[model samples]
Target: MSVTPQASGAASERTGLRVTYDGVVYPAEEIARGAAYELFSADEATGFEWAPRPGTTWPWRRFVHVTEVTEVQGGNEPAEEPEAPLLVPLHRNRSWSSVHQLSQQPAAADDPTLAAVRGSATVRRGTRMVKVLTGRQLAGYVRGWLPHGFCYREHDIAHLRTPAGLAVLRGDGTSGREGTDIGYALRWRAADPGDFDAPVGETYRGLLALPPRDRLGPPVLGTGFVPSSAQLIPEFVTRDFADLPMPANASLLAYTAEGTEVVLYTYQAEQRGWLRMVGPQWRHLLAAVPGLSPDQEYVPTGDVPRSTQLVGSYAGGEYEAVADLPGGFRVLAMTRAARFPVDSVARRLRYARWRGVPCLVLREEAGWLRLRLCRPDPDAVVDTGAQCHERGVYETWAPAPEVTDDQVVDLSYLV
Candidate 1:
């Protein structure tokens, strides 16, 4: 959470928002070069929506007007002029408005620019080295739970310190990682509960018990668990689960050890229980992980598992490929499927029933095998194919594409 809390003169502005970014608000004219945003709102939450934060809209708060802009000398072009902070009261419901215009391309607020001298909101805490993530980053983390059919949520977190240790009871860390809302939360480990701060920890734990998919109420609370003796109660709780269409008042748990330098771990779940690698080489690993779909079949051929049937055929005197398959019966105009598996599925088809009519001669030229996305894995037992594909039947990780000429397939088109 690098968004610096810009104190609104003796008053609070955008009180409940989960701050997503912070930077100089770009002027409307320079919006393209100024900032980038996700078009998300609590009203219609779905995907990673991008846009600038909304502006003020209350009655008394609306009194403060946007001050005149004064351009500073810098950049090849002029620097963005700053608008003096105003104190305008807005309707609490619609109070959260973008600082920039919303109807058109927005002048993004400043969030990306960083300096050696200036520390981020994460850095300022000074207790634990924080891994500050953008709402976009947070959303991606939430999506990883899809394969296993789980969903992770965001909540306001405020770790209030206590005597036993930092016990959170009512902190916004369980706050929403929202599109329209923008706010911040902190994660720290004081020597003891009250060693450094009070109320913050108790507040954080309390949020874990919040009900799921409901974001309109106060944050929930959690029972104290010894960090050393326990694993996250449900492994899924600690993961960066994204498939969650339903949101829960999730926990912002700290390492139980006293000042053990709590580290944050991110989890991503796919259609299966698959996960992308986390930490070091994350850039390269994330890029490669999706490409390597683990096997998704139910049977075994030699050491290989039954998977998508990928076969290339000679059609019209030219060499092409067959589409890969995971199920039976397919329709392929041209076949040139590749060999790869996500969990245990394969990508090669040795043969398929050549479709035909009983005694119909000219009408039945006999069509060959076809490839597709969700077909079943091939194996001996019709009963076995069902069992294996459903529970990782294959052993071989399908090889890469190698369309050899002599390969045989049941279809006449196969060479």
Candidate 2:
């Protein structure tokens, strides 16, 4: 029932279909197309796909795919219904409510950092505040659907707002932190509908081309705010650290307040999304580690091995990475041993698989290694006897080396 007129200079002008499902109606072209694609795509349409919004549950799935779609105009008679089960109605497709709590004042009225500011867009709705997305954020949302087995999408343009404007808010938090943050997205006018791989927010002026739309009125916000427990994209808050090269076989771990963490695998490149700690285990680790503080950094000294080396027999010893012990202070488990044959510690560990069968080797700190168990026999016990002898004969162990300050990236920025 709520409506916000398209921005003045949108690249295209097209009438949107009015779709009624489960009693609620949507007038946005993108919503209509998404709804139609879900409910009325031809039986032979091979490429149609849908990205079920996050936190979708039972029963709703039955009705989302309808045998027949009814496009409402002028309040015409209801279309003939199939014998299918009733569809669950979504209310918040086309609504906007003023935000009440301002997190940070809107971008200084005229900051040149629209993309940066917009990248972290949050809008006010009544007394509640929500996140909004634009550009790549929107595109990523649409793409997330297909991979999750929603439906194969043909044209992403259908998701675009008329008049070719940016700052398309995925009403409420459909693709963001539900009930908390509103998602803002940008729809590119020149985007190839069939090609969803196009870069987002590439054309600066193009994204900011349309004048901002005024958002205030009734139908205030979409009604169907699905209860979501997952965020479409993981957000990272970068901080400045002394950029420096890591020591041999070392990794840096980053932790945040929401029980979220990512291991920094900088050896190959400045990569992310390595091993993580979450769920019950996260709760356990969170008991320590500075109490789950966001933007907290945990640099590994690689002095103590995450895994323990056990001498099963005289032949060799087995090294398996194990969980960390909870504590407030750090201790270095140091020992001396003979050096190994391999040039690099990673290669040495990689060559130590007892059965001569190859498995993934994840290097912890120095003197410790964890095998990425990939063999079918989950219960198969590993023989570290031969490897232990090899280690004593071919490898040398020394005290955990000191970490140099210059090896960190200076990502700190002033608020």
Candidate 3:
């Protein structure tokens, strides 16, 4: 019973993925089975793994996240106790395995103000705030899953106990747009090393501190293959207020809300910063209850620059900025390309059922064909053997390509 981490090229240009195999390689069926139980919500990101039928395409799989797992230690020896969940060893694989995660703070998770950026689609009438929180947490988690390196920072929010919640705001930062994506500002309960000895608390200290660094590919090209666990349980306390003791064993808490986020805009402040997760979601976002500034300041996020490349039809229409996903997929945000109208692209995506999901249809790049898809699918079964002519027709930046469905591609060397 040996476990190892392996990563291969993905189906898209922007997807991050990694594969774990025991003594024997895991069949696609097993991978598909895990999807069913994979905990995708950030607040519920325990990383145990989900069980779903094998997907023809990647949905909420392949990203970066942490799992609080408890396995009996002193292996090769008799089992002394049962498995438990402990906060430790964040998974940095680009592989879809990251889709499976557990939650540390369920309360914040249930709030809708924090749902995913796509909450509008999943959110239904009569939805509670908790469901919304889950959606928002997913957005930031996916962003950290970017194929390249992501700089992780730390922040301190003074006054853990605030008359106006500024105390909690000290340690954390706001995420993305409020009407769209909401985020939370939480601090983890930093535990003592001795605490991990018990099975209940997350084992993030000592020998059990990490989930095997091998799981993270390489520090550079494989950003997902970075630190598996904190060298020590990092303690986070509130900032900017009168004296207040922080929560022990606290590290993160996510919630969503419908208001402007509090940002410590000083560039020097961002220099040695903590994680700032902003996205369109319901969970992990907190609503501006009667307490914190109720009138709601309508400060618009300044214009994000357009991209060098435009995706989809050329007939330019309503478009967002060209967005960059974790893997390698980058396209103007749901906007229209030059010739193709954004409306038609929307219609096609609705027809294709791939509105939010990223994909790579072959397009020309420096004369050679380049695949541009959303977060690349780890262990993607590309059909290169099939002639290039068989590939599907897709619209892309500068170079337009013919879309051919289900072409066999050969990438053994890259694999």
TM-score of each: 0.16, 0.20, 0.19
- Superposed by TM-score, candidate 2 places the C-alpha of residue 65 at a distance from the truth, in angstroms, of 8.1
Error of 1 at 289 (Å): 7.8
lDDT of 3: 0.21
Per-residue accuracy of model 3 over 279-356 as CA lDDT, tens digit each = 333212334321222222221222321111222333354332121111111224323342222322111110111223
lDDT of 1 by residue, 1-415 (tens): 1121112211123223111212222211111112211112323233212232334221111110112223311213324322112222335542323211211111211222211101111111112211122233333333331111111111111111111122212112332333212221122211111111111123233223323332222222122211112111100121111011111112112221111112122221112121222334222212222333223211111222222222333222322222221122122332225222222211222222211100101111123122111111232123111221111111111112211121322222111
Model 1, which residues run further than 4 Å from truth?
1-38, 41-281, 284-415
| lDDT-based ranking | 2, 3, 1
- The best-first sequence of candidates by TM-score reads 2, 3, 1
Compared to the true structure, candidate 3 yields what TM-score? 0.19
- Candidate 2 has a TM-score of 0.20
Cα lDDT of model 2 by residue, 44-67, tens digit:
222223322222211111112221
- Candidate 2: Cα lDDT at 134: 28
* Model 3 CA deviation exceeding 4 Å by range: 1-224, 229-299, 304-415
